[model samples]
Target: MLCGCVGLVWLYEGDVEVAVYLIWLALVFDFLDGFVARLLRVHSPMGKELDSLADLITFGVLPSFILYKMLQQQEVDAWVPYLAFLVAVFSAIRLAKFNIDENQQTVFIGLPTPANAIFISSLIFVDGSYPSLLSYPVLLIITILFSYLLVSPMELFALKFKDFGWKGNEVRFSFILFSALSLLFFLHLALPMIVMMYILLSFFVKIISTT
Candidate 1:
């Protein structure tokens, strides 16, 4: 919650990069919350619901706020900011879907909110060296696309390792290795690219598996 508060403040102050960094920290804490819960063998339905609430703030609202500010700066339209809120709305739906989804115990049926948040937050880099990426048209398309992805029924892979074997896990291993290479070579730009790669690779693997 503290991280969420700081992210809100930094975003309001127009320090978008710092706001994004805070979100990354929040993600770390988010992961640790589940890991710690499992370690202690304490599971509550309340805790599950509370975690979703927390995610709505950090992953959903924060990234949407980032887009809202960017839209204001770009002076696209008053309605564009409202369009940004769709991200939050769809993210909430995605969380709800995840809760009820038995198939998602091992994989996701849509873009995870955290991945969507990271992809959106990583765009602040465009504000610096790649300002072209912040054009009103591009941002609008991205806003619409990501909002759809949050709720789309496309299956996505989870990062969980089911076992030590590398045979059936080849796709997972490839994803990790390529993501690492992207970070090494592309730096911050690698983030959005990695998100795109994740979606594309999942689709490709699904097609191959079915065939």
Candidate 2:
């Protein structure tokens, strides 16, 4: 959560790049929380609850702040920027469902908060390169679209690996390869692309599975 707090500070300081990097760092730690818990064979309701709280701050609130600041920067109407908080609101609902939904063990029922955070935070680069692409209207649309996606009934795949083998993991491996190459070739520009690729890849996998 410190990373998230620091990100908010940097964001307020007008250092958006640093704030975005912090969000990425927080995501890494978020993944580690689960991995370490499993590694130590220590699992409890308290730990799970704490994990969700940390996620709310890092993935939910931090990203919303970033989006809020972005909209504010656009100099839109006074109350319009407040809409960015919808990301946090929907994120909380998504996380709450995740905690109780047993069907989400190997797949997500909607866009995961972390992925949503990454997609929103990565928009900083788009704003940097193509200022017109993220105008007030566009950002508002993104806010509403993603807010709905957070709680929508989209079946997104999880990156959990039962084994490192090739069989039964074709889609996962392909996704990893695509993400790696995108990052290698595009750098920060790949952040949002990777998230989009993840969603499309999940849909593709589902289609092939039902055939």
Candidate 3:
């Protein structure tokens, strides 16, 4: 609760970098809650429900707030900020569906909330490094494209360690390695490029796996 409140305050103050760090802290709490539950064998129905609610606020609401801040800096019309909220709406649906979807026990069928949060946070960081790219038209287009990715059916994203080793892991591992190098070399400027690589690589892997 403290982390969530701090994150909301950061968002309200337009301190996106601080908000991103707070969201990472929220993720840490999320990890510990599950770990503690399993460690003590105290997994109750209430715990599950509370975790979901916490996730909605930490991952869904906070990231949307950052996007809203980015859109506010744009010179576009009013509808642009509203459109950014779609990321939040889709995130909620994704989380709810994850809770009910049996197949996702092994792997995610869509973008996971943390990954979405990281992607959004990376954009905020990137904007500081590349202000010229955050024009109203470009930000609008990016919002629409990412919002589509949030709900896109054909995208097969990897969310597990197995998807990173041996046979078919070659491309995925290479992509991650290259992405790491890019980040080390270019810092936040590599964010969107790396994310694009992830999406495209995942799409190609899915295609090859199917055929």
- Candidate-wise lDDT, in order: 0.88, 0.90, 0.74
Query: What TM-score, computed on C-alpha atoms, does each candidate reach?
Result: 0.94, 0.95, 0.81
Residues 82-163 of candidate 1 have per-residue lDDT tens digits of 7888899999999998877779876789899999988999988857778976898888899999989988988888887768
Steric clash pairs (candidate 1): none
Displacement of residue 190 (Cα, Å) in model 2 is 0.8
> Which parts of model 1 are misplaced by more than 4 Å?
none
Report the lDDT tens digits of candidate 2 across residue range 102-141: 8998899999999999999999998888798888989999
Task: Give me the displacement of residue 67 in model 1, in angstroms.
Answer: 0.4
lDDT of 2 at 136: 91
Pick by lDDT: 1 or 3, better one: 1
- The residue pairs found clashing in candidate 2 are none
Per-residue CA lDDT of model 3 for 39-60, tens digit only, reads 7988866776677777777887
Q: How far off is residue 180 in model 1, in Å?
A: 1.1
